[model samples]
Target chain A: MDQFTLNLLFVGASFALYIGIAVWARAGSTAEFYAAGRGVHPVTNGMATAADWMSAASFISMAGLIAFTGFDNSSFLMGWTGGYVLLALLLAPYLRKFGKFTVSEFIGDRFYSPTARLVAVICLLVASITYVIGQMQGVGIAFGRFLEVDAFWGLLIGACVVFAYAVFGGMKGVTYTQVAQYCVLITAYTIPAIFISLQLTGTPIPALGLFSEYTPGGEPSGVYLLTKLDQIVTDLGFASYTEAHRDNLNMVLFTLSLMIGTAGLPHVIMRFFTVPRVSDARWSAGWTLVFIALLYLTAPAVGAMARLNISEMMWPNGTEGAAVSVETIETDPRYNWMLTWQKTGLLDWEDKNGDGLIQYYNDGSEALAARAAENGWEGNELTNFNRDILVLANPEIANLPGWVIGLVAAGGLAAALSTAAGLLLAISSAVSHDLVKGAIAPGISEKGELLAARISMAAAIVVAVILGLNPPGFAAQTVALAFGLAAASIFPALMMGIFSKRVNNVGAVSGMMAGLLFTLIYIFLHKGWFFIPGTNSFADTVDGSLLGIQSTAIGAIGALLNFAVAFGVSSMTAETPQEIKDLVESVRTPRGAGAAAADH
Target chain B: MDQANQTPAVDKEGRTYWKANIRLIAWSLAIWALVSFGFGILLRPLLKGIEIGGTDLGFWFAQQGSILVFLALIFFYAWRMNKLDRFYGVDEE
Candidate 1:
């Protein structure tokens, strides 16, 4: 079969599996719809959570980010995983003990305020909707590449698939489907890494291969892969691969933001509610990390190895010799990946100065400028390579079998669709369970609530598809905003609610609003108000940031502000009721968490 | 309501169980911070000479070691907490 047909086969089989799971596990009631009837095993929930958490960004883009920047980007790895520590330790067990179908339900009852719940719903919606948009767009892109169709057709198909599973299966369906997705994505990710690791370092385990000696032609070169990478990259005017170069404070804060954001995201937090017991919630978080670690550990190796491959490909005669000729890149079978990627417009090259050689180097580096002058090279020729293409094109770049490429296409869609399904569940629960049942129509029947949940889920999928088709120009910035809102607002509020009975409703509401608005305005100042181009008052660079903390890192400071404001407001306001304090005390213990219940 | 279900003895045991839980959390969080934030970033310069496979110990911690440590810490926490629940008679049926 041709490459496209193989891709279609792989992707088609995965979709059939997901839809089958959805049909088999179709939710029949509110209990199953919202929290999978609170019966999922911890390990199963963990596997599903891994799929839910590892979105398009984690599966597709993160390795590229780490590969290009080296050790400075270690924040992505540490921050994303470390949050589970906070979750398992501080949040998950207690929330599970509370036994609610939705995160806002916990907030509403614990704080004893509908307004607090509404504010939380707003926060959850903002973070989840923005997050879902990114996933939808990711689905579209993956579909576009594999299906050889426009992104719009890809998006429409993805939406219909999501609607079929999510609207019918609810959390029950999504959980089982996500478990299948995790398997597909992890296999697709690790297989290529294993191949590339064996090729580069002769170590089958990519994690160990990263630290092992460089082996070309099946023999050790007596030089470590990182050391070799550092030498070649610096020769091409890049920073050392293993050295830290970013500002220490910003890195700390940015990592902290991601950690808190990970713990706070409603979709992830909601998964803990599906487990049978409080202790399972704790075990589930660990299981999630265990699964997530499989990918996180391999990602840096993929980044470094891809970097080495690209550098070697550009300087086929070695860095000290002439660049690869344009004619060779155009015709050589080994360089076929570049031509295929170039057709997508994400990878491009030009032989500047009319030279037959296409030089690839950091033109901005002063040290490299001298080398370029000596070599009679005009400028870097590989000018338009998008980082997102690195993972998708990796199998082809390594000249892996065509089936591997097909597997990766299915894996990418699985990552995007699984996350999108999880986010839609969070959104719909907030609308139907928390908002409609708790606030708007308290007399609504359980069956009516289930219908509302499905309707809202369908609505969320529609919105996601529309936004995916015409994403706001600031895809990266909106992601930052999502993390910022989660870190600054939802996480602190949840932590304080669980950890302290003294924080009253007024205090919680005010703190959330303060943190939400402060982080939002800070990001707006740097990125632009509402992400409109040319509307930013300050540049996004370090010099333009407040206290050298970029907008991405501002969430940590906003969280601190939340804690201070909540404490200050509570001290001056009314003390929490004894009953509410009793509620907090009960949530802390693991006894009597029979099943997740909705209390109106 | 939970308050109605809880007698004085259960409440007292629950408080003690919670206290023990908080202490464990504090300790785990400290190790978590020391590994990732301390060894991985701030104190990386101190461990430059302790080289492993290719790079210094700090880089290893930043990319691989800290993640492994996080895994150990989480599993340990879960195991210990489950034991605590059983000891305090707070575990579910």
Candidate 2:
């Protein structure tokens, strides 16, 4: 079968499985819809959380980012995984013990104020809405490439699929479907890595393969994989592959932002609420990391191998050999992936200086540009190599079986759809459960609330689609901004609520506003006001950033500002109510946690 | 709504349990910081002599080692905290 047909078959099969699970596990009541009746197994919830956590960014864009940037981007790996430690130890068990359906419920009840809940809902919506935009764009990209349709139509179809499952299944449907997604995505991710790893280093394990010697073409190069990669890239005038290229301070703050943000995200935090016990919440966090690590550990290996492969393909004999002829790139079946990706406008080449060869190098480097000038090359010819295409195109680049390529297409869609559904659920629940039911219409029936949830979900999808058409950044970077927003606002409030008895309603509410607004303004100033492009006063240059920290890494500072504001305001305000203080005490201990009041 | 659920003995025990939990968290987080930020990023040059595979140990720590340690730390904390929960009579039946 043709590659497109195989892609349709695998993608169709995966969607059928998701819809089947949604139908079988249709949520019966608000309890099931919101929290899956608090009966999910720790391991099962862990798998679902992994699916919920690893969005389009993790599955599609992360390895690609790692491939090109090398060691400077290790922050993405460590930051994302290390957050589970914070979640398990500091957040998950306490929140699960508090026994509420949504994250805002805990903030609302703990602070004993509807306004605090409303503030949290706003933060949740902002973070989730931003996050879902990346997922929608990911879905569009995956569908556009595989199905040969416009990205907008692909997004509409993806939104409809998500609406069908998320509206009907709610958290319950999303939970099980996420489990299936985790399986498909993990398999799809690792199989190709294993194939590439074996092909590159003769090692079956990608992580160990990263450390193994380079033995391509059955010739013992006697150089380690990373060592050879560094040599090759630097020789070609690129930065050393394994050296730190970013400022140390910025890397620290960026890692901290991603870590805290990961812990603070409402969709990830909400998953812990579904498990049966506080202990399970802790266990599930660990399990989620194990599943996430399965992809993460292999990602660097995949990246390095693919970079080597691309470098090798460009320089057929070696880096010193003649560049691959443009004629070959245009007509060679070995370079077929380039042609397919070129149609998506994400991959393109131009023979600058009218040279009949494609020279892919860092034209930005003066030294490389000089070398290109000496070689009669005008500039870099690999004009638009989108980082998001690395993993999806890896199997094709290595000439793997058609089925492997199809599997990757399905996996990318599963990753995007699973996360989009989870974020949509978080947004809908915040609107229905926290905003409407908790404040606006406390007397609303469960059925009415369910209807409201579905409507809000559909509305959230539409908003995400509109924003996705003009995504502010790459999938992972855009997702990282969501983490920053979450870190700056919601996470600190939730943590302080659990850990402190002194923080009052006024403190939490003002703190969230201060953090949310500060981070939003900072991001808008740099990324453009409301991310509309060309509206920013200052360019995203070193001078434009505060203390040389990019807007994406500013969340840790914003979170610190939040804590300072909360403590300062709380010291002057009245103490928490006695009942609320008791509630704080109740959440810390594990007994009677399983019997959390359904709150319906 | 359930003010009657509160007892002086439970409150006293809860305070102790919470203090112990805080101590545990403090220690665990300190290690978490040490591995990821300290070894992985800040103190990486200091550990240049220690090499794993082709890369230095610190680079591996940044990318892979720290994640494994995080998993271990969380599981260890969970197991220890569960034991502490049972000891304090705070574990769910």
Candidate 3:
């Protein structure tokens, strides 16, 4: 079969498997719907959590970002993974011990205030909805590319199928499907990396291969892979691949924000609630990292190798040789992948100087200016090579088998769909369980709540799909907003609710509001108020950023402000109730957490 | 019912367990910060001489070492805390 047909077969088979499992594990009760009946094994839940956590950005965009930016972007890897430490150490076990259905419920009961729960629900909704829209857009793009359909039609079909599984099978179905997705995505990701690694370094493991000798023509070279990569990139007038170029303070703050945001994301935290015991929650966080690390460790290798491959392809005779002629690009079988991607308008090239050769270099570099003038080159000729296409086009670029290509297509879809389902589940429970059952209809029956949960789940998917179709210009900026809000608002409130008894309702409410607003206004000031074009008071650049902290890195400062405001407000206010103190003491232990209980 | 009769004693044990847990957390977080933020960023230049794979040890920690350590610390905390819980007669039935 051809590549398109093979892609269809792989994606179709994976969908069939997921839908079948969803039907088999259809949720029967409110407990199963929300927490998978709290019977999930720690390891199994960890695999599912890994799938839920690694979204389209992790699978598709992250490797490319790392490849282009080099050491400066290691923040993405470290920040995203280190949050599990915070989750496992500070939050997961206690939340599991609290025996609550929703994160908002824990806040409400812990603070003994309905307003606290409402605020948490609002934060969860904003962060999760922004996050889910990104996932939905990812699903549409993946489907449109692999299936050769209009993106709108692809999104509609993908959304409906996800809704069937998520609304019907609930958390139980999503968990098992996500486990399967983890297997698919990991396998698809690693097979290509292993092949490329062996080809590039004569090593089977990509992570080890990254640190091993570069093997050109399958023979070991004395130079290390990273060392060779650094030479080639720097020779092209780009920064060294192995050296840090980002500002130290901003890099640290950005990594910290992502760490806290990863811990704070409602979809990820809800995964811990599915495990059977408090200790299992702790172990589950570790397992989640192990699974996530499998891809993360391999990603840098994939990135560096892809960069090397692109450079070699462009400079077939070496970087010092004459550029590859436009004739060779038109007729060469090796350039077929670029042609295929060009049809999608994501990859393009132009010989601006009419020199009949395409030169790929850092045209802006002063060091390259003399070389360009000597060669009569006008500017860099290979234009519009979008970084997002790197991971998806990697197997093709490396001349891997067509089956590997098909599997990657399926893997990208799985990553997007699984994360979308997880986010929709988070939104659904927040609305039906926290908003409606907790406040609007406290006397709701179990069956009625179950019905409400399914309805809200369907509604969430609809909203995500609609927003995804007409995604605003700021769809990308909103992701930073989501992380900032979660890092600033939700994480601090949750931590204080468990760790401090003195933080009364007034204190927690004010802290969340302060953190949320401060982060929002800072981001808006830089990225345009509410992301409207040309309305920003300051440019979204290092020079224009407040106190030299970028909007993306401001979440850490926002979190610090949250801790400060909460402590300050609490000290000045009335003391926490004695009952609330006892509640904190109770949640700290793991003795009585047999079943997840509804607060009502 | 039996636990209700031993309230004061259980309360004392709970406080000790919490204090022990906090100590463990403090130690783990210190290592966590040291690896990702300290060695990987601020102190990276100081360790430039200790090279691995043609790059400094700091780059290795930034990419791989810190993640491995995070995994180890979590498992260690879980095992140690479970033991602590059982020792304190707080393990779930």
Candidate 4:
């Protein structure tokens, strides 16, 4: 069968499975819709949360980022995963014990002010909506490449699919579908990795293969995999693959930002509320990491191996020899992945100096540029190698079978749809449960609230699609900004609400506004106002950064500002009320947390 | 109903339980920071001599080792706290 037909079969089957699960598990009540009726097993909730947490950014872009940038990008690996530890230890169980329908609900109740809850709702919406834009764009990219449709049409179709399940199933539907998605995505991710690992290092486990010796031709038998990769890239005038190139201070702050952001994200936190007990919330976090680690552990291996393969293929006779001819790239089956990707205009090459050979090396090096000038090579021929294409093109790059490629397509879609659904749920719940029911219309009926939730979800999808059409950055970068926003605004407020009893409503609101505004302004100033491109006052380079900290790493500093402001304000103002103090004490204990309140 | 009636005793027990939980969290977070930020980034230079897979031990810790440790820490915290909850008479029936 042809590759496109196979992709259609696999993606169609996975969508059928998700829609089937949504129909079967349609939510019946407000509890069912918001919290999955608070009856999900710890392990099951863990699986669903894993699917929700690992978005298209993780599946499509992370390994590719690591592949090209090498050791400097390891911060992404550590930062994204390390945040779960904070979530499990500091946030998850306690939030579950609070037994609220939405994260903002806890903020509102704990602070004894609707204004505090409203602030939380705005923060949640901004972070989640920003986060969902990446997913929407990812869906478009995946569909555009595989199904051969325009990206806008692909986004429209994806939005309709998300609406069908999310509007009807709510959290209850999303949870089960996510469980299925986890299986599909993990399988899709691991199979190609295993094949590539075996081909490169004779090891089935990609993680261990990363450290193993490369003995492909049996001559020079014990060259370590990373050692060989570093040697190969450096030989081509690129930086050593295993050595860090970024400033240590920025790396540390970046990792810290991602950790705090992960803990603060409303979608991931909401997953914990579905579990049966507070202990289960803790255990569920562990399980979620276990599932997530299956991909995280393999990611570095995939990055290293893919880099090695691309380098070796480009320079079959070593970097000193003649480059691969353009004729071979056009006609050879091994190079066909470029043809499919080039159609999307993401991968391209130009024979700038009319050289029939393609040179894939670091043209930024002055010595190499001088050599290229002597050789009549204009510049790097591979002009637009989109980093996001690395994972999607991995199986094809490795020349794996058609079925594996099909599985990857399905996996990519699962990743985007699962996260999109989870974020949409967070956005809609904030609208109906926190905004309308909690504050605006306290006397709203159950049916009215449900309708409002559905309408809000639909509206959120439309807005996300519109924003997705013009994403300010790559999927992972945009997602990282979402994390920064969450870390600065929401995490501190949630932590203070639980950890400190002295924080008052005035303090909480002020801290959230300060953190959110500080982070947003920094990001917009560097990335453009509202990320409109070329509207930014400052560049994102090291010279343009404040104190050499990029906007992505500024969240940790923003979070500190939030804490200091909240503490300072609270110290100068009135103390927390006795009733709210009692509520905080109740949330701290795990004894009576199982029977979650159906309505506030 | 019986536990609700014994509010004063339970409140005392809850205070003890809460204190114990805070102590546990402090220890866990300290270790978390030590492994990820300390060994992975800040102290990476000091561990340059200790190499794994053509990379330093700190690099391995940054990319892979910290995640494994985080998984263990979360599970260990859960198990230890669940036991503590029962010991302090705060476990859900």
Model 3 chain A: which ten-residue window has the lowest total lDDT? A471-480
Q: After aligning candidate 3 to the native by TM-score, how far in Å is the CA of A145 from where it should be?
A: 2.3
How well does candidate 3 score on lDDT at residue A534?
A: 71
Alpha-carbon runs more than 4 Å astray in model 1: A27-31, A149-174, A436-480, B1-4, B9-12
TM-score of chain A of 1: 0.93
**Per-model TM-score versus the true fold:** 0.94, 0.96, 0.93, 0.95
Predicted candidate 1 versus true structure: per-residue lDDT over A330-411, tens digit per residue: 9998898788777656688998877898989999899998888977878889988767678888898888999999999999
Provide the lowest-lDDT 10-residue window in model 1 chain A: A472-481
Tens digits of per-residue lDDT for model 4, A566-599: 9999999998888777777777778777656656
Candidate 2 chain A minimal-lDDT segment of 10 residues: A28-37
Q: Per-residue lDDT tens digits of candidate 2, residues A1-600?
A: 899999999999998887777666773443366556267778888888898788899999899889999999998999899999989998999888887667887888898888998999999999988898878878877877897665567677777877775765454344777789899999999999999888878999999999999888767889898999998898788999899988888899889999999999987887787688888888889999999999999888888899999988888868877888889988999999988888777788998877798888877777677677778877788888888888889999999999999999999988987778767877887888888888899999999998899889988888888877777888888888888999999989999998888999999999999999999898888888767888876666566675577888888988998999999999998978887877877777777775555675
Q: Compared to the true structure, candidate 1 yields what TM-score?
A: 0.94
Best by DockQ: 2
Between candidates 1 and 2, the one scoring higher on DockQ is 2
By TM-score, how accurate is candidate 4? 0.95
DockQ of 3: 0.56
Q: Model 3, B1-93: lDDT tens per residue?
A: 012322342367788988999999999999999999999899999999998987989998998888888889999999999999899877775
DockQ, model 2, C-alpha based: 0.67
Better of 2 and 4 by DockQ: 2
List where candidate 2 sits over 4 angstroms from the true fold.
A26-34, A150-153, A168-174, A441-455, B1-12
